[model samples]
Target: MPGLYHICYLSVAKLSALQPTPELGFEAIKEKTRKANSAAGLTGCIIFTGQHFLQVIEGIQEDVEDTFGRISRDTRHTDVRVLSEGPIEVRDFPEMAVNCGGDETLTAEALAEISAVLDYPQHQLHIREIRTLLSVLTQPSRKQDALLAG
Candidate 1:
């Protein structure tokens, strides 16, 4: 069977959510990914900024496609935009990967904040607030390609 290469753009921001610093928060999230990937036998790379995240997950063609689609509404993500997708003959993340440390900062509080917004009264959801939230939860994932090259 041929492996597959995939990239996903996910936006998650935690302006003041994570305690301490981004490096610590990144560590926390990476740990979670590690466990999840192990359980599912999936491989991928994840990157984060204070305002967004880009990830590339690969595995069985069917499984990878299904998994990538599920991230659209993942609890960890708020506003998701699928910038691009394509098929490949090999796994991009042969064994799951992550790069978050050494001066790396984290941002994903916006995703949590948006989830909270859903609890508010419907009338309170302003257009501007939604737009801001989208921006906060939107991240470009082009670097995922570079991650492999790097």
Candidate 2:
């Protein structure tokens, strides 16, 4: 079988009744996204910082591309920009999809961390930075508080 690939992208949310109320809307989106991802045999994580979204998905190339295509056409998002994509020997996230909800302080910090790497030359991001980004996005909420504390 062909190896899986990971694709990361960032997007801004379009104005909508649900978009305006992030807490509720984010959960709704996450729930729907999780269900779809599960059915598609994809696994990864997504972070929503109220206005912006960042997601990393891992799966067969066709499935990943199809999922991304559907996401791009979804009415909820705008300004979709792909950050990175390439084949991987192993899945970084092999289980359930993770949804990192909006927490102002943590979100700001995480965005700053992600932006630094993204601002680098295209596809030139250091492996360490990529791992760090995954760590930041995948940290559980309980551990996230500890992350902020230390």
Question: For residues 35-102, could you state the per-residue lDDT of candidate 2 as single tens digits?
Answer: 88889889887777656677888899999999999989988888898878889888777877554545
lDDT of each: 0.52, 0.72
Question: Runs in model 2 with CA error above 4 Å?
Answer: 17-20, 103-131
Tell me the TM-score of model 2. 0.75
Candidate 1 residue-pair clash tally: 8
- In TM-score terms, candidate 1 sits at 0.52
Stretches of candidate 1 above 4 Å error?
A: 1-5, 14-23, 95-150
Compared with the true structure, what per-residue lDDT tens digits does model 1 show for residues 1-150?
565655545456454554467557666777876776677667765656445555666566676677777766555566675544567566544533443322332234433343444444463445334332333223235423423342
TM-scores of the models, in the given order? 0.52, 0.75
